[model samples]
Target: MKDNASLLRRKDAATPRGVGVMAPFFVSRAENAELWDVEGRRFIDFAGGIAVLNTGHRHPKVVAAVKAQLDAFTHSAYQVVPYEGYVALAERLNRLTPGAFPKKTTFFSTGAEAIENAVKIARAATGRSGVIAFSGAFHGRTMMGMALTGKVVPYKTGFGPFPPEVYHVPFPTALHGVSVEDTLKALQLLFKADIEPKRVAAILIEPVQGEGGFYVAPPELMRALRRLCDEHGILLIADEIQTGFARTGKWFAMDHHEVAPDLMTTAKSLAGGFPLSAVTGRAEVMDAPAPGGLGGTYAGNPMSIAAAHAVLDVIEEEGLVQRANQLGERMRGRLEALKTRVPQMAEVRGLGAMLAVEFCAPGGHTPDPDFTRAVQARALERGLMLLTCGVYANVLRFLFPLTIPEPVFAEGLSLLESALTG
Candidate 1:
C-alpha cells in the first residue's frame, strides 16, 4: 500500500477540491475511539466521523445486527417491498424523540433528504411556502438544505438560484452580539418585510448550531420560537442532525428545553455509522403529504435500519446518555483549566459530550482562526484528530465517542493540552 503522502496525492488527483478534507492520512481501521492510518500509525479519534459515531466504529451490537440483516437480504427497497425493520425503527424514533403526542417517522438516505422532506411535510400541512431559518445555522449540502443554511462562504458561494421563500434571521449567540430578544424581533421584522407570518410554513433551527460552532440555543429562545410558530401557525422543525442520538446527553437536544417542535429532522448518528436519516413529527402533519409523495427507492435499507435498532440498544445498554454527560464534564473541566493557562482559549462550551473550545486573539474578541489551525495541526502531529468549526473556523469542537476508554480519553486530553500550551 502507498504511504500517506502518496495516497493523498492520488486522492487529490481523483477527488474534487470542493469536497474539503481535514486530514491528510487515510484510515485503515478504527475501534471505539482509536484509528490506524494506512501506514500503520495510530491516533486517537476525537472527530468521531463528524459526530456520526457516537456509539463508536463497528460497535459489536451494531455490527451483529447488520450482519444478521445482510444474511437475510440487503436491498429490498422499503418503498417497493416494505420491511418490518424500517417500520420498527421509525416506531422507536417516534417514541424516543422529544414529543408525547402521536407521531410518525419516515426514513431517508441522508440528512439533506430528511430536511427537504420535513420542509415538504410542513408546507403540505400548513399550505404555505415560506421557511424561516437562522443565521449561522447549517441544514445540509443539498440545494434546499443550502437554501435554509445561514452561512454563505463555502456552502452557498457559487450555489445561487437556491429554492425561494427561504429567509435567514440572526441566531442568538453571546459571542456574536445577537440576543434572544433581538432574534425574536428579527423574526417579526422578517414577517413584515420579506414574508408574512401565515405564509411561512416552518421555522427550522438547530438546538445547538453544529458547524456554526457549538452554540447552545438559549432556553428562552426556544420557548419564544415555539410561541412564534404556534401563533403564526408555522411548524417548528428542530434540525437535530448533529445533536441527536445521545450526543447532547439526551436522546435529542430538544430535551434540554421544555419546548417541543412540530417536526424534527435527524441523521448523522441515527444509524450508528451507517447512512440513514429520518424525519419524525406529529402524525397529522407527517401524513399531510400523499403516501406516494414521500419515500425514496432506498428510503430505509434493511441493513441501515437494523443497525439503527442496534445502535439504540447499545446507547441504552451502555448508558451512553449518562456516559456522555460524564465525558463532557471531564473534557470541559480540562478545557476550563487550560483556559486559565491559554488566554487565546476564549470559551469552552457545549452540552454533554458535544463540547468545543473557541479561540480568539489575546485581549480581543476577534476570532483567531490561525491559532485554531495551529492547535488542530499540532494535535494531529501528536497522533490525535480534531475538527475546527464556526463561521470563522476558530472553534475546535470535540466529538470523541462516549464509548472511548478512560485511558484513551485521558491521553487525547493530554495531547490536546500539549497542543494548546506548546
Candidate 2:
C-alpha cells in the first residue's frame, strides 16, 4: 500500500545513510518463516533478520515471556538491582555452551560490545595487548571491533588508524583456495612478523565466518588454535554471534569441534528478537575485568534477560537443534544439485541451518558476484528475500527460519531454481 511506501520514504529521510538498508519494504508483521509487508503481501523470510530469528519470529513461548516481563517491569540494569532473569540467562549459557571448565557469562546490548568486552577481559587476564583476527571477518562497526574485522570496504573504509596491536591473518576456505595449512602459516607469520604470541591477548574467530560467508572453521583448525593458545597462553575466542542458538544444529557453532575455546561470544538470536549479547568464558578469564569494568547502561537490562531466558527454554524444549540439522541437509542437498544446472555455482557448504551457495565463473575458479547479484534481484522480485556475502561479494547465503514448514521451504527452493535458470 501507499502507506508502506510513505513509511519507507520517511525512514530514508530520518535514518542515517550510513545504515545500508535494501528494498524499503515495511514489515507489518513477521511470524515463523514469513514476513507480511504493510500492504499485506507476504514474503518468505529466508534472511531471518540475518540469522537473528533462529527460533522464528515471535515464537509463542518467547512472546509470552516478554509479555509477562512487561507486566512486572522493564529496566533495572543488573548492576543497580539484581534480577532473577539475568542470573537465569547466565546460568543457561554456562550450562549450554561448550567447555567443561567453570564458566561465567556477562550480557551486553550488541555483539560488538560483547566482543569488545571479551577482548578486554582477555587482555586484562593475560596482561597483553595483541589480538589476531582473520581475513573476511566482520566484527562490528565500533572502532575496536572494526580494527579486528578484516573486511575493508563499507566496514573499515575511511575509518582507518584503528585500534593498535590488531592484526589480520588468513581464514581457511577450500572453495576460495585457502587451506588450513595456509591459515596456520599465516598465524605463524603473524606471530613472527606482527607480534609475539606471548604478547597476544587473544585470537578471535567465528566458528562459521558470518558476514564473510558461511565458511565453517575446520575442526582441525580449531584444535590447532587451541594447541597454539595453550602453548602461548593466548585466549581462544569463538564468535558465535550468528551461529549460536539453533542456527548451527548446536547450542554454539564451536560445539562442532572437539576443542573448546577459552571464551565464546554470542548474540543475534540470544534474546529472540530483542537485543542481547554476551561473553561466556572460563571463570578465571571472565573475572579478569574488575567488578565495574565490563558493562553498559543497557547491559543485562531486565527485559532483554527475560527474552533470553525464554529463548534458551524454547530452544531446549523444541528440539530446534535437530530441526536445524534436518533443514540444513534438505536445503544443501537441493543447492548441491543446482551446481549441475548452473556451471557457475561454485560450492554449497555449511553446518546445520547456516548454509550458503557460492558462485564462480564457468571455470569454477573466480567468484561471479555479477551473477550473484542477478540471482538476488530475480528472487526478490518473486517475493523471496535473500542476503549476499563474501569478500568478493559472490555468495548467496540462505538463512531460512529453522521453524519454516516443509512445504514453504520446498516452495522457496523451487522459486530459487526458477531464479537461477532465468
Q: By TM-score, who's the top model here?
A: 1
Residues 179-286, model 1: lDDT tens digits: 998998998888888888989999999999999999999999999989888887989999999999999998899999999999999998889889999999999999
**lDDT to native, each model:** 0.93, 0.89
Model 1 misplaced stretches (Cα beyond 4 Å):
none
TM-score of predicted structure 1: 0.99
Off by over 4 Å in 2: none
Candidate 2 lDDT at 272 equals 80
Cα lDDT tens digits for candidate 2, 374-405:
99999988989999999889999988877787
Model 1 has a clash total of 0
TM, every model: 0.99, 0.98
- Relative to the true structure, candidate 2 reaches a TM of 0.98
Question: Cα miss at 400, model 2 (Å)?
Answer: 1.4
Candidate 1's displacement at residue 268, Å, is 0.9
Q: After superposition, how far is residue 404 of candidate 2 from its true place, in Å?
A: 1.1
